[model samples]
Target chain A: MKNFMALISGILFSLGLGLSGMMDPKKVLGFLDVTRTWDPSLAFVMGGALVITVVTFRFILKRKAPVCEQNFALPTAKDITSRLVIGSALFGIGWGLAGLCPGPAIANIFTGNVQMILFVAIMVVSMIITEKLVD
Target chain B: MTISSEFTPLLSLSGGIVIGLATTLFLLFLGKIAGISGIVRGLLTGKKQDRSWRSFFIGGMVLGGLLISFLKPELTAKVYEFDTFKLIAAALFVGVGTTLGSGCTSGHGICGLSRFSKRSIVATITFMAFGMLTVFVMGA
Candidate 1:
């Protein structure tokens, strides 16, 4: 049941990503390129999502546990470490360059785009390498 | 700055709402944040018992993208092109960065920020700033 819910959630999330033009690297880059004909569409996407979350998340979290789960697997770390800032900064540079993040990149895996395929492959390898180094 | 000609406020907003709904469902039912990066990482490094749901969720995303491509081919179409070296560089940065940071756009930007997490807020701001800066520096 939990897996099914996850499946449903993933589908819905991807559908939203697709419908919102978030799947396209160009669109994402367009949003990041603030100096030249900035695309505010990404902002709207965040805004719209936030509107829903901001309103309902509080109530949802108020419960002792989720309907189908025993506990919320929430993030425990609260520190603003250099790891967070530097890591995000690096991610931003990559995002600006490729306009592909994890979600859209994964979704585009089956699109038969060789670039995307390579990108995802390299990204996965990098993740593994980072993990080994960090651990 | 001039607005891009391709801006679609309604479509993007509606899409966002859909994303919001998905995350909400994820939290409400599974008691987990619908963070793509965290999910992927969990799939990679988490315990054995936790793998199935992550796989299912990821599979669902891939399937959903495939479904959308069939229904609306234009949505998933690649508009811009990047060189091979650049793509590799970008991918490396993203992979390492997301791992170190513990989230990405979905996890930190949406889920984390929505939850009013200080870590997420900082991560989001840092990424956004750097993203814009990179675009500016690269002149892309």
Candidate 2:
């Protein structure tokens, strides 16, 4: 039951990304390129998503548990550590270069783009490295 | 709706709404954060129960992408071109950065900030600043 829910959610999320032009590396670059092209479309994307999430998440928070889970698995860490800062900075630099975040990269995988395959393979390798070395 | 000259605002908004709906569904039903990086990581580190749903969700993403391209046809459009050298460098940065940071654009930029987590806010600002700075610095 939960797996079905997860699958459905994944499909809808990817659909949104595809339809909104979020999957386009060029579009993502445009959004990030405030100094240059400055496409405000993704701002609208973020705004629209926020409008829905902000309202609904509050309602969900009031509930005892989710439909498929006994408890909510939420983030627990609160401190703003150096790991967070440095890691995010590097990630952002990568994002700037390729405009392909993890979600969009996976969502666009079906396109059989060699760049994406290389990007994801490396990304996974990096994730594995972080797991072994990073505390 | 002020549409950007190069992009369509209506479509972007609708797309975002759908993204939001999917995330809300995750929260309401699965009690999970629809964070791609975290989900991927969980498949590696989480208890046995955690891996299956994550795999299913990722499968859905791949399947959904294929479905869109197959059905809409127009949405597939042109596949983006890549420069091999730059692409490799970018992917490495992504691997290290996302892993060290504990999240990515979706996990931090969307879910984290929405949850009003202080750490997420800081991480979000850091990444956005660096992303813009990187582009400005590289002039790419």
Fraction of true contacts kept, per model?
A: 0.81, 0.76
DockQ of each: 0.74, 0.66
Report the number of clashing residue pairs per model.
0, 0
lDDT digits (tens) for residues B1-140 of candidate 2: 11123767888899889988989999999987788888877777667978899999998888777777666534532367767777788888888898889898778877887888888889889988888887777754
lDDT minimum window of 10 residues, candidate 1 chain B: B73-82
Please give, for residues A54-97, the per-residue lDDT of candidate 1 as tens digits.
88799999999998888988999999999899999999999888
DockQ leader: 1
* lDDT by residue for model 1 (B5-117), tens: 48889999999999999999999998888889878877887789989999999999998888888888677744446677889999999999999998999999999989999
| Model 1 chain A lDDT-worst window of ten | A108-117
Q: lDDT per residue, candidate 2, A2-62, as tens digits?
A: 9999999989988988888878777777777787768878887877788898889889989
Interface RMSD of each: 1.7, 2.5
For each candidate in the order shown, give its overall lDDT on alpha carbons: 0.88, 0.82
* TM-score, B chain alone, candidates in order: 0.92, 0.86
lDDT of 1 at A131: 83
Each model's chain A TM-score: 0.96, 0.96
